[model samples]
Structures are given as structure tokens and as C-alpha cells.
Target: MPKSLAEVEEGRTVRIVDVVAGRGAAAMLYNLGLRPGARVEVIRSGPGPVVVRTEGGTFSIGRGLAFKVLVEEEE
Candidate 1:
């Protein structure tokens, strides 16, 4: 099932299924290497920023922004 990146547990690797953000937000995420089909590992998920590691690099996403990223568990 698809869930928000913020909902994903730490240490879990997930594939970005969709971005439910506005154009600007989507573009920003895209620029940060977080677009649809991108595979990212949840480095941290909690009250603070959600950290994700991708092939490009690692990023700290804000709660609101992370919530807009739809992801599915990998494996």
C-alpha cells in the first residue's frame, strides 16, 4: 500500500510512488532527487525532519513535505 514518507519507518527502503504536492513543491523535491520511481531509504522518521537516502544523496525533508511524498515499501 502507498503511504506518506512521514509514515514510513526508519531503516525501511521505499520507492516513491507519487508526489501529492503542488507544482512548486513537486519541482523542489524533484530538484532534490526525489521524484516518482525514485528509491529512497528512510534514515529517520519521527517528530523531527524525515531523512531519506537516495542514489543521489541524503536529504532531510520537513514533516509537511514528507507527508506529500507517497511511497511504497520495497521488498
Candidate 2:
């Protein structure tokens, strides 16, 4: 099922299905090594944004942006 990144609890992994296209969204996310099929774990969430730990590194994405990152969760 589809869910927001913020909705994903910490320490859980999820496969990235799609990223919302924007002026530089793809490139930006790509720079972080966030591509389709990539798995990411939610490190922390709350306050202003959600933090996800990826292979490339850690990135902080706001709730709005996190919502755009469609993912299929895996338990």
C-alpha cells in the first residue's frame, strides 16, 4: 500500500517506487542515490521533516516532499 515517508516508522525499510518530478527533484534525489528499486530506512521523524537514511547518506526532506516519494513498504 502507498504511504507517506513520515508514516513509515523509524528503522523500517521501504522500496522506492516513484518520485514526484519537479524542476530539479529527480536530479536532487538522484544525487542522494535515491532511485527506483532503492531501499531506504526511516531514521527519524517529527518536528519539521522526516529523515531517511540511504546508501548515499542521510537527508532531511520536508513533509510535503516526503509525501511525494511513493513507496511500497516491506516488513
Candidate topping TM-score: 1
Q: Tell me the whole-model lDDT of each prediction, alpha carbons only.
A: 0.95, 0.82
Model 1: lDDT equals 0.95
* TM-score for all models, in order of appearance: 0.96, 0.84
* Stretches of candidate 1 exceeding 4 Å from the true structure: none
lDDT of 1 by residue, 10-49 (tens): 9999999999999998999999889999999999999989
Off by over 4 Å in 2: none
RMSD of 2: 1.5
lDDT digits (tens) for residues 1-75 of candidate 2:
877676787788998888876859878887788877789989987667888988888888888888888888986
Locate the minimum summed-lDDT window of 10 residues in model 1.
66-75
